[model samples]
Target: MENKKEKKQSKGRRKIEINKISKKSSLNVTFSKRRQGLFNKAGEFCVLSGAEMAIITISPGGKTFTFGHPSADAILNRHLTGNSTSGESSTNLVKGFWWDEQSIESLDLEELNQYVESMEVLRKLVALKVDEMEKGSDQSPSDFLAMDSNSLLDAFASSEAENIE
Candidate 1:
């Protein structure tokens, strides 16, 4: 009798479509890995050039992460002060900035915007659940609960905002 062993074939890397990933679990996994890779590259660049670097990423799951070589705050502050040059002194232009003025890159502002969007989605879901409870919706509680966060959000995004409010 002869014994034969077959080797498992592995598919090498291939190009992927750049469209939005629809699967929630897969999307989250890909987002996290890519974000980590980006941060790692930035760190490498900083180490090689002795340059300051910062990266901020917002995930679809409402997670916020930051990477900095030196520190993210120091890099951001230098940029804001218009003194990114190696030998220049930075003036405090932010001192006189008004509250109404906006800096989208501000982590607080970015985080706040993300929080608001998440809350809006939650509110819509709650309103829908209440309405369905009263009307005896075709969708069962189990079915609704089984949906991933992204699916739940997508379903209610087009709902009547006034009614929900």
Candidate 2:
């Protein structure tokens, strides 16, 4: 006969029931952690799939927290104005860096203006990248890689700062 001893251990993972937490403190803690986890996953999704997302959540206490890939404003505005164009109709819309000439006629004046501004921003960024490449120092991996939303936003911010000064 063989005797087996049950090892004492806490449950590794448990399925959380779909129910509201009765305790305010526990709910708050769970909300905070889960919110962060959700935002982290959203960011990862955006980076991996070249997708954009915006999550606006109001806590039980009424405080609002936002997680936006690229930007909440851009995503929300695109949704509101129905400016989201995809597929072969638009060129590089995913990167927001370029658009096809054929698609230019489809845009309103505001959209055309916005596209022009985006192109200007991209031009400035390219100039900066060229300068960096010329310098051949402190070359970031992003310099040679495809521009993700974060890097693109950073480039925009830097360009805006340069313009301001």
Q: Judged by lDDT, which candidate is best?
A: 2
Indicate which candidate wins on TM-score.
2
lDDT of 2 by residue, 11-119 (tens): 8899977998999999988987898799899999999998888998777877667777676666777788788753422233455644443588898998788678778
Give the whole-model CA lDDT for all candidates, comma-separated: 0.68, 0.73
User: TM-score of predicted model 1?
Assistant: 0.43
Q: What local lDDT score does residue 20 receive in model 2, on the 0 to 100 scale?
A: 89
Provide the lDDT at 2 for model 2: 54
User: What CA RMSD would you report for each candidate?
Assistant: 14.3, 11.3
Which residue pairs collide, candidate 1? none
Q: Candidate 1 regions off by >4 Å?
A: 1-14, 86-165
